[model samples]
Target: MSFKITDNTKVYIAGCGGMLGESVYQTFTDTKCTVKATDINLTAPWLSYADVSDYSEISKDIKSFAPDLIINLAALTDLEYCEKNQEQTWLYNALGPENIGLIANELDVPVVYISTAGIVDGKQDVYNDFDEVNPLSIYAKAKYHGEVFTQNHVRKFFVFRAGWMMGGGPGKDKKFVNKIYKQLKSGQKELFVVDDKLGTPTYTKSFAKGILEVVQSGLYGVYNQVCNGDCSRFDVAKEFVRLLGLEKDVKVTKVDSDYFKAEYFAPRPFSEKLVNLKLNARGLNVMPDWQEALEDYSKVFIEDLA
Candidate 1:
């Protein structure tokens, strides 16, 4: 599978406001691929505002841009929010990708869809590309729909399933790691984390680079794109405190999911680690370990706090 994308090749990125979308946009730009970024809320010079649910809106943009590859990175990823607002979640997560797939199919162009490892039943120790999906929440179910729709609708598509994304974006991060950092930086001396819930944390920039490698290779299918190691919320919080040189004595306590029953009522998978077998088999490198990725990511904010 040999593919070549030059500076003249146009690549359009949908959902350019989120962390993953921002990283994808930057990666393509760095690679010298002619890029056009689009999102519903166009805040940056590179972004064009368009709602993906409106077929006319997305189709018009696709037709006008005439890109060789379209990367659909827009998704409604708030698990609890999805549980509360099922209709909006499905519309944004499932229907949005369906519309993108339809447009890409009509134009006979490939689409790179960013999916999530959350689709797998977290009961399993780890999941691979071929693992059965047992989504525990509306958010995961919606993302799974996007994955299925993409595969069925488009002849050439790459579904990259990423886990607990970190890094990139401007104040858009709400993952566990970022939350821990915020709490600690706010001068909280104690933190309570669930020791049972487990998954790999992915750095957006590294994940974006892996996706580009797959695109350049022209090997299209579902692939797990995540850091090399897995950890629980407790593990991540501990690492966050350690890296910041915060007091090791800053009392970190372990609790069960039941502790936050009111705040997090949505059913969550206990573990959602995804193995990057496909990338490895193809001789393509996956992202670095979550610990290493976090260390690099902390550099951006560590100085600001100090």
Candidate 2:
């Protein structure tokens, strides 16, 4: 399981407008690899506009790029939105991956599909790559289907499951960390955070780096790529406030899940933490701790607040 990417090797990344896609692009840039970034909403000059749901478009792109690897990062991750729009969610999250897998399989290229910890049953204390997935939400179910299709259709594929992703994106990121940062920066002094749900907070950059390691190793299977430790939403908010030096004035308050039930009515796994035993056993490095990654992210966005 060892493949080398020289300067001449072409790499294609789907859904390049998202935070993870941005980080993946940066990682590839650092490695000096030939990369083509694509997304349906290609606002940036670096991305090519294409809809993955259209098999013709996907096939055309794969044939034209002739990439050594195709990384599918496109997914509909909004839990509530997906709950309400089940058809759209399934089309984008599940069907898109299946299309990409088919195209990559035809081209004889390895495909790397990004899945989520949400696919796992949160009732479990901890989940590994071998754990049976029992998705609780539409978004999770769609992503789980994508994982299954990728594994079945693509002979060479790596499915990476991540949790509570955090990183920089123009308008693609709307996760817990970004929402809290927005609230704190908009002159909000008080913050109410859920303390019940628990999972690892993954930094997109570290997750991207881990993906590169896996690709280089040429291992074709599922892996959990997330930060080293687990914590609640309240813990993440507290750490964010601390990093911004606003802990004292921010007035962070911990609340039960029922308090925000109205806003987040979608079903969520109470615990989506994933164990990195497989990655560690294979000698691949796990991501940094959430606290450490948050500090780095804070340096970029917190400065704007002041």
TM agreement with the true structure for every prediction: 0.96, 0.97
Clashing pairs in 2: 1-217
Give Cα distance to truth, residue 287, candidate 2, Å.
0.7
User: What ranges in model 2 sit over 4 Å off?
Assistant: 169-172
In model 2, where is the ten-residue run with the lowest total lDDT?
Answer: 168-177
Error of 2 at 296 (Å): 1.3
lDDT, candidate 2, 1-306, per-residue tens: 687888988899998888788889999878888999999877578998877878898889878989999999988777999999999999999999989999888988899999999987787888888888899899998999999998877899999999999987325567888798788878899999999999988899899999999999988899988888899999999998998888889899999999999899889988999888789899896599889988888877766765
TM-score for candidate 1, residues paired by index:
0.96
Q: Write the per-residue lDDT of candidate 1 for residues 27-127, one digit (tens) a residue.
A: 89997979989998765777879888888988998889999999998877678889999999889899999999999989898999989988888777999
Name the best candidate (by TM-score).
Answer: 2
What is the lDDT for 264 in model 1?
87
